[model samples]
Target: GHFRDNREIAEIMADVQSTLLDLREIKSNDKEIMYLSDQVQNANTLFLQCINKLNALPKPADEGTMFVGSMLDGFFGNFLGSYHRGLDAEAKQNALNVELQSAIAAVDQLEAALLLLPKVAEKYSATLSDSTGRIVVDFNESWGYSGPNDWLVLQNRGETLKDCTILVQLTGASGKVRKNVHFLETWPSNSSMWGRYQSGEEVLGRTVEKTTVTQVQELDITIYSPQFATQIQYVYQGAEKDKDIAQICKDLSFQGAYQPYESGVIWDTQRGAQITLNGVSYIPKCRVDVAFRKGEQSKGWHWNHDSWMKGETKSFNTPKGGLTFDPDRVDFEVSFPNTNYKYKSTLTVDLKSGK
Candidate 1:
């Protein structure tokens, strides 16, 4: 029974290994890949435990004599007798069989779950048109845009998006409305075609001058894709402080620090304070809000009106009036504007100002 059980377990392991190899080839996001890999590890661990128990079973005494006696019994009336030497060995073997069965069931369930994971697109392309019915904007696999038009394109890199409804607002060089609330749709794993609106026509059927595409000053785009919705927590790994500013603040006195520079003031705009934030987003078109605070006094910069791309890093500096004193903390907040998904992180600063 032990030999047969060991052989069956070996076969099950081989099957599971093949399935894991297939899983690595599937195109999915980082989160889904991690989840599937964990399931495979759990199944492999269970198989190892079952093999260890099978090998630890006691061997039968006098195997040759026992085999001969068992053969004679099999030919006679005692064919169904126990194969092991004692009741204890029989009980242990029974328990091992139960455990082996459970391991096999786990592998089966893992394979079933693998079949249910969705196949997501690896990349996408977007094409936009101007009022002249010409393709004025083209975005390729790298999400880079090329054309004579002035526009902002926000691309979703790794996240899965389906049936996306995009709202775009275009402004001319005079900061007047060239276009507003133009709706566009994007299909799954396919390129998007936009700019179906007629020239000089607004969403409310108002008429405006047909402005030149290249004279566009600002472009705002917002996307609503229910299928691409997922909660993401943007982690604040840390902040990189400016070395020059740090050295200046080290020997400065917090009291009477308001004096002008070259007149004995320690910190000022000439010796500005700045910190570059390191962040990586898995999704695109996010809004970033950064604030630097020292007690009740705080300064903030909002990027809610702009688009923050995936895997992009943003840097912040001290307000127009540079930091006269060391900041106690800095806060970073990111969210998808017009959506409920939001994430916030705070960093406590130790400026080592020697004050």
Candidate 2:
């Protein structure tokens, strides 16, 4: 009877269960997939803990003593199947949350891979060397991307590699070069090819010995990671479209900056200073100036040294930028145009360096 009469506890249990189940539909706002995954696991543990506490509650003491007591006890014991379905609801909620989290992670990864596709394509360039019967195949870098549903497709216009038989050589990261042959005689439009290579697993098993070519675009090659494009351009100038791809990746992957410091030469009271701003994306053109004054002057401190204020560094940390730097008995100030950070330091005479 007492258990059946506890309306507040019953309502609280119902609310928690509802909330736990609702997590399945709510999307995670966290940007990091791994962090969100950990959060879901912890939430599941908490849900189980709450359910166990409710399940541990004792039933009415003297339920079998009276008819009304026995009936009420049965009703209380089976209230929303609380006692019968131990951990089942919580388990289902956890599974649902996990499934949702996995889906979110998969989508995020695929989007990232898609964003990098253009850059990867730019690195696939081909050109003919002056040497007779030899084609120079150059690669900016070799990269790989993987997902659940992964496959490579090569799209070519019937004219890109028409009737060109040439040896394909791939230079790996360790400078080991592997060679293969690609013969394009009357290439078809929108066809596929699979082949086996004698060296470098990166190019082998991608196409058959003889397959028709599919002309989709001027140069549309959708290759899986670890595989690269080896077609050549018939022009004279070196490829420059994807030249900044490597730098872009570095800029994107930068996590944070380190402690900023000033460096340069310090002789007696005269100091020549430069800020070697230490950061993951530090560029040489960034504007970093050291302002200092001798003794106390009304004009205040003056700009002593400034780095690439008009060059490429001006765009750094903006659409554009670290390094570590230098001084004695002087007041110093560091200024960054892109950000709202200001740094000032005082140098004593003992800190002077000749070099």
Candidate 3:
């Protein structure tokens, strides 16, 4: 009788949605973000505690948490425990098994999808905080994974952030291969989180344009532009998992599935270092499509960076004639998964500072 009611649950749910709504609006100093963030967290905690309490309640002494056993044997014949009357426990166990397995599968399938959305947001709308002088990204534009193949997009228009470089790393969760990509192509190897420019020397003037993955353990990205420099990391997996949940809705509510099942990085490099590029290489700047596997391969996604999924398709085409940095601004977008909901805003970055 003292249990919390559905009305209370509804109130908490409203609080969550309301807080998230506020999270979408922006004020110059992230004051809205910080305040709304706390409200959202609190609402989520309250909702979860209430839900857990209800789910864990002992169903009157008769209904037992083991109610499923009774309902099961009473309806469907039990082959394993034909003589036992405790079939109730078995049914409850079966239901719980299905639920837990689904949750874990969701994590396996959607982890990459969710992880990529933030990167897409940061990649485009990343901002440089004047207070700390460090480029900052918060997990606001998260992803919803629906499948293994979908559109990914990130276009930033942050006007007040600029003057640094960019770096990116891709790796497998198995700790087997490490991949790295640098935007500046300079700034020396393994530099600190913040950049240090030489006297009167442009950070972009240094050599070494090749992007290499050190091992399968860490996949990371660092960007250095005029006054903008930051890096991001995510865990990758060697094992294949179901990817049907990464679907995103379009303009007319039509759904689209986005999968980054295959993890890698792309960049514009100097001509001399071009030979190092492999595994479905495409010169987006030059429109040159090079099939590293010579146009004959299968399951090639698993192949190491040097040799992608052997026996798989490594075919792709690029645009003609190299890509030139706009100096004013840049954008990167990721495929989105088809997920149905009222929220349909995508990320956009505008370089307001250094542009």
Candidate 1 clashes between residue pairs 3 or more apart in a chain or in different chains: none
How much is 166 displaced in model 2, in angstroms? Answer: 5.1
Please tell me which predicted candidate would have the highest TM-score against the true structure.
1
| Top-lDDT candidate index | 1
Predicted structure 2, TM vs. truth = 0.20
Q: lDDT of each prediction vs. the true structure?
A: 0.37, 0.29, 0.27
The C-alpha TM-scores of every prediction are 0.23, 0.20, 0.22
Which 10 successive residues of model 2 have the least lDDT summed? 67-76
lDDT of 2 by residue, 146-185 (tens): 1111112233433333332233333333444333333333
Number of clashes in every candidate structure? 0, 33, 97
> Residue 228, candidate 1: how far off, in angstroms?
29
Model 2 Cα shift for residue 127 (angstroms) = 19
Between 1 and 3, whose TM-score is larger?
1
Deviation (Å) of 350 in candidate 3 = 76
Tens-place lDDT per residue, model 1, 1-355, is 0011112434444544554444445433456655756765676576466546645654333343121112111000111111232234556546545654554455445433433332211122132322222112321111111222222223344334543434444554466653222112333333333332223212112322222232333445444444443212211111111221222223322111111122236644422223232332233455667666777887666664254433344444445455455556767675542234455666666556421
